[model samples]
Target: MEIGSFDAADASLKFGAAAEEAALNTNVVVVGSLERLRDAKDCHKLQRVLEASPDKMQLITSVARAMSAKKDGASARELYLLPEPVETDERSGSVRRVCLIALPSACSRHNSPARPHALTSCLKGNAGPGSLTVVAMLDDPSLAFATGCAIVRAFPTWVAQSSTAAKMQSKKINVIFDAPDNEAIPEAEIAVLSWAARAIRFTARLVDVPCNILNTTEFVNQARVVHALLQSTLQARGEEANAVSLEVITGEDLAAQGFGGLYGVGKAAAHPPALAILKYYPPGTSAADQATIMVGKGIVYDTGGLSLKGKTGMPGMKKDMGGAGGLLGTFRAAVGAGVPKKPLYCLLCLAENAIGPLATRPDDVHTFYSGLTVEINNTDAEGRLVLSDGLAFAA
Candidate 1:
């Protein structure tokens, strides 16, 4: 039970890598309480050991073959999980990089900078207290891929809102049902399945929309449609999406906000710059459980300010608003869900790069809304400039 005695020799391993590497076989088994693995030094040892293996397989099984014949001998299993850890790719044996967790459930990765299952953080247990199994595997790692992503259970078999507080039994499926203790909400599967299709479509469409059609103004406009759809679910999909609250702040309005980063980037364009903001507040729940702010980096056109990008350097700068599209799509989902308790905020900063005398110059000392004066090192770096002011205002 002493953490000091245990070395986290297997701390860096991921499930897939642990399974794939025939030579570097490993699995983590912790004896005794959670307290033992919680120590800082012991955790370090576990990390080093997990990193030692080289496999990319998700559900890895290995046997400690050296033991003699016995019933409980090597068959018994113990499990441990590190909330977060960093290590190189034990699967491909590529350059070591900082991965998210110690044991990943399902990972699809490549040598590229953005790899799969890499960003995923496994949920070691179930939705609530002790009921969630401290098992050997992860539940759909891809479901919670990014930092802000979360898992939620949507529909229930039947509604049970009423309850007589004093007449409760020690154990029973209450008249009002949440998840009964110790049972994994099978709904995460169905709910995520429904969400996945749309998430994939949104991800793919936004990916294809090309930065040209998905600028700050367009992005905000699209979000307005999403808001309208939320207000009334019966609203038809395509054209109805266009009939929402579309408020675009431009010209002097954008300038008055002192968002010089957005203004500077949009100044060269014949079309005035735009700052777009959209909001959605669902009925009921006065305070709301939580409010999330979705902000996208909107670079309408990146001609590279004064430091122009050549043909090859600028092939896909148009898609710079990928983050914005992601945010808008997420809003669409929140709207589609009839339960609108929490208020959601969507902000998109937009601008196009038009080459003219007014265009910002390289090494230009552009002032940001946050009042941080950045030396314009490169015109092509305009994305960060526009994002800076947006981020500052967001703060």
Candidate 2:
């Protein structure tokens, strides 16, 4: 009946703060050729490990190789957490956990995909919930951004499982860029990454929530909540609240508008099928000329209708609305990034593809909103039906 209380603002604030603090306190260790490693500062722990292993290249290359020999057979990465915490600043007697990130010498020429794979693989397994991870800055901007995104993407696993746990678990991990003193990466850039991460997490959570809790009506209501948050943020900044608006069309309105595709697919459910549109029109922007429409499928729960799916397939039907979830997340992120000046529209075609006496069956032909007749050969293909209505309307 509800997706319950998931607050977006609270999540953004918490994640951003944690990431900033974590970046400041990171104990950085640089891995490269022996000449470079010896010249690198603040890598005392790494030096000790090299002393024991006696082979720097082997130590880096065999990070997962040696671990695979253990009984668990777990997938591992090149990042290793030193058993002994190293003194980050000897004068202040400050110490932090030293994590070694291996980068090849002359990394610019390196083109191995395993670099990011190793980074995310290790962090996903070892990093704690709501913890901050700091990696030494990569000279390549594209690589650094990709690594940051990977770090942010890993946080959602915990969020998806948090509801079923005994203690409310945190699924947010802040990944900060650990640049050298000479580097001047702005704080705003890091915050942008946090916003992007939260958006991704938000989308994943919406898709992961059970359909019973996120039915059509509830999904629309959730959109309203997000819109209201946007309105509030705009008002606080003395901007026009009407710049962003949400319009929801459902039930008789859908029928009156001749949305046969949406109606045919959703009429069987207790909650009526709906089309929710979130529109953003910045000042002085012509809605007709400067519009970009984003469409998402919002099948709250797909039971495959009369062409019912097997029990195994039904369990994962909750993710049928992933498109809508991702759209909404992207909407928020775009707004947060302050790039919504042009006219933008997000159309969510929402419905529950449930079975009932009213459900459209095989051999049924429905005239869609665009006046196109579609024969229902199999109700399992109903997602396309609803999406057709959305595309037609948006176009």
Q: Which prediction has the highest TM-score against the true structure?
A: 2
Report the alpha-carbon TM-score of model 2 versus the true structure.
Answer: 0.76
TM-score (C-alpha, index-matched) for candidate 1: 0.48
Where is model 1 more than 4 Å wrong at Cα? 1-196, 211-216, 234-247, 283-290, 338-341
lDDT of 1: 0.44
Candidate 2 lDDT, 33-99, residue by residue in tens: 2232333343333333223233443454444233322121113233433333348632332333334
**TM-score for each candidate, following the candidate numbering:** 0.48, 0.76
Taken over the whole model, the C-alpha lDDT of each candidate is 0.44, 0.64
The alpha-carbon deviation from the true structure for residue 76 of candidate 2, after best TM-score superposition, in angstroms, is: 4.7
> Once model 1 is optimally superposed onto the true structure by TM-score, how far is the C-alpha of residue 80 displaced, in angstroms?
45
